[model samples]
Target: MTSSSKTLGEFFDSFECEAFRLETLDDYSKSGNVDAYHAFLAGQPQPSDYNAGWVEELRSHTRAGKRVHRVHILSRPLTDYLSFELGWGYRKNSTGGEEFFILDITDKPNPLAGVPDFWCFDSASVVVMNYDETGKYVGSALLEPERVVEFTGYRDTALAEAEPFVEWWAKYGT
Candidate 1:
């Protein structure tokens, strides 16, 4: 399918080399997994099947030697959602070989300020993620080819300034 006709989900299926995501929000409580998030808040044990579908998808990509990774831009004293995400989501996802990075800007200024969350596929297709203030999934926009270069640079900067999640978690994860 042509880029014009391709959706963000389709890009995940079609990318040949790597998929990079830049996460800027701290709270995605309204986006998905509401039940799980609520359970986490109640101090319940995480279900073994939590996030299973996404874990399987990550395995499909990483097992083929394709990279599916992301850098989450966040600050210290993580929000409840961030805690749940890193504590549960990222930890489980990593078991499937998906890589994670942390861009902690607790003291330093945000390097990619004002940039919306997005996913860049194979450094070719850029899809801008739109979310409501409450972090609900609004929709996504697939940018034209000309905007790919800009998003690629954003990805590069984020990766360069971010620390591997393991190290960050070792020092800061609670």
Candidate 2:
């Protein structure tokens, strides 16, 4: 199928084996849950319903034996947005069976430097997510078939070098 023929949401709903994401940004505060971000910044406790829908969506996939996970590429001295995302968002999401990892490049060089944020579904299809400088949601593109080979390679490298989120969080989480 052509790039214009598929949407990321379609991929999310259909992937069978695994859905892997590589997050290359330190901040996505302006992208989704603006109100929750604001509340997090204001020092309010996370609402009970925070990310409930997405968590349910994740549970639906993981309970059926598929995998959903991501590796976030970041460095030392976490940004406020990163603090909110990791401390609140990731921890909350993981409860629903989504796995996470942290690939901190504070000391070592990032092996996948400059790679855009992408989601690889079943290691077969890739959808590149776009964001503006301020981290506002822009759009996404379903990459052509040939590009999945390179993205799948990137995915493997990320998983190989990254540490599980629980372990990383025990050491570095805010």
TM-score of each: 0.97, 0.97
Clash count for each candidate, listed in order shown:
0, 0
Query: Which segments of candidate 1 are over 4 A away from where they belong?
Result: 1-3
Which whole-number lDDT from 0 to 100 does residue 97 have in model 2?
97
Give me the overall lDDT of model 2: 0.92
71-137 in candidate 2: lDDT tens per residue?
9999989999999999999999999999999999999999998899999999888889999999887
Which pairs of residues collide in model 1? none
CA lDDT, every model vs. true structure: 0.93, 0.92
- Count of backbone collisions within predicted model 1: 0
Off by over 4 Å in 2: none
